[model samples]
Target: MKDEEIIELYFKRNERAIEETDVKYGNYLESIANNILNDDLDVEECLNDTYLKTWDKIPPTRPKVFKAFLAKIARELAFDKYRASRSKKRGNGTMHEILDELEECIPASNGVEQSILGQELENIIADYVRSLPEREAFIFLSRYFYADDITAISKKYGISKNNVSVTLSRLRAKLRTRLVKEGYLAS
Candidate 1:
């Protein structure tokens, strides 16, 4: 079913909205969860949580892109689960590594002022990503947004692992420069 039709189902408070959403976006949501959680059981739980979230949010929130909305919910849930699990066992994973890489570029969230600044920084980064070349943007989002593994990204792009690393390093440097120029980061 199309996104509009599925959204209409939600608006009407029809239970079938969940089923239609699962049919259309289950894998996409699962992939996002899998990237963060890395455990089958955890991924499944996150996906179910995403459906419930979508159901609750749809009545008042009509998203222009349903897939992105679902994916965002799934991603945030997966991150929450990942953080909880890490507090118990700090095992390094793709999500951790990617976040660590971004830690330097993104500003620290101190207080309300920094919170607003963080949102602006996020917008700037999003715009920068959108302005990138197709291949660069794909690789950047895959590694950062989805937290895909370096080896997996290289394999998917049919490129060497070193090349991927170089590309990412350059992109991060460019981002840092842009942030500094925009006064988000101090020189």
Candidate 2:
């Protein structure tokens, strides 16, 4: 269903809005939750929560891009779940491991995870992402943001595995340098 149709359903207070949304964006929303939560159960909970939050917010707030709107909610819920459950500190998954590696290069600031600094971090990261070459940025986000496997990203982008690895390494070095120059790192 088109996003405008979905918004119309929400405005009409039809419960099928959630159903249609899940049908369209379930995998996208699930992947967002999975990136932060690690476990399937936690991810599922966030997926359901995304539906509920979308239902609640639509009357007062109808977003222009449904996918991005849903993704933001899913990401926020997953991050909250991760912090409250402290799964990140445990390093129980590849997402945690990868993020830890990046964190070592550019640590988060203040109580930034729960505040305006989060948006600041987003701006910095987005700028860095946009600065990368097309293939490098595509695979980099596929791995880091979407948590896609290297082979899938390579296949989707029509690149070789070695190219993916090389691009990732170069992107990491470039991001680290940008972070350092932006005073987001010293290490």
Candidate 3:
């Protein structure tokens, strides 16, 4: 079902909303959860949590973008579950793994404090994303923010896996340059 129809079902408090949401976004959600949790059982638990979260949020939320809404909740929940299960020294197998790839261009010591206002951080990141080519920005956010896996991102964007990898490589390079310019990283 389309996101609009699914959202309508959610607002109507129809139980079938969960079933249809699963049928439509289950694999997508699972891929994201698995990327963070790296365990089948935890991924399953995260998916269930996502459904419950959507159910709770739908009545008063009425999201303008349903899929993005579901994804944000799922990603945050999955990451939370991963963090609780592991020590800070043990991070999940996520795009964080690749962050080191750009650390050379922009040293990690210059990181911003997390307590900064969310909108401020989003605006900064939005400006950075806007500096990228449209495809590069989309692919980068799809991988990192959306937590989409390589294969699915390739399929969704109608590009090959290798193409996605190359585009991401270029995007990361550009982002590092931008980060340095924005003073988020050491020169």
Best by lDDT: 1
Who is ahead in lDDT, 2 or 3? 2
TM-score of 1: 0.94
Residues 113-162, model 2: lDDT tens digits: 53666667679989988988886777877888776666777899998988
Quick one: ranking by TM-score, best first?
Answer: 1, 2, 3
Give the winner by lDDT: 1 or 3. 1
Please give each candidate's TM-score: 0.94, 0.80, 0.71
What range of 10 consecutive residues in model 1 has the weakest lDDT sum? 114-123
> What TM-score does prediction 3 earn?
0.71
RMSD values for the candidates in order, in angstroms, are: 1.3, 2.9, 4.1
Using alpha carbons, what is the TM-score of model 2? Answer: 0.80
Across 1-187, the per-residue lDDT of candidate 3 in tens digits comes to: 7888998998999999999999998998997888777789989999999999999999889899887788889999987887577655666455455444444543433335644444554576678788777878888888777666778789999999999888877777776677668666666
Candidate 3: regions farther than 4 A off: 88-96, 99-113, 146-170, 176-187
lDDT value, residue 162 of candidate 3: 97
Show where candidate 1 strays beyond 4 Å: none
- For candidate 3, give the lDDT: 0.79
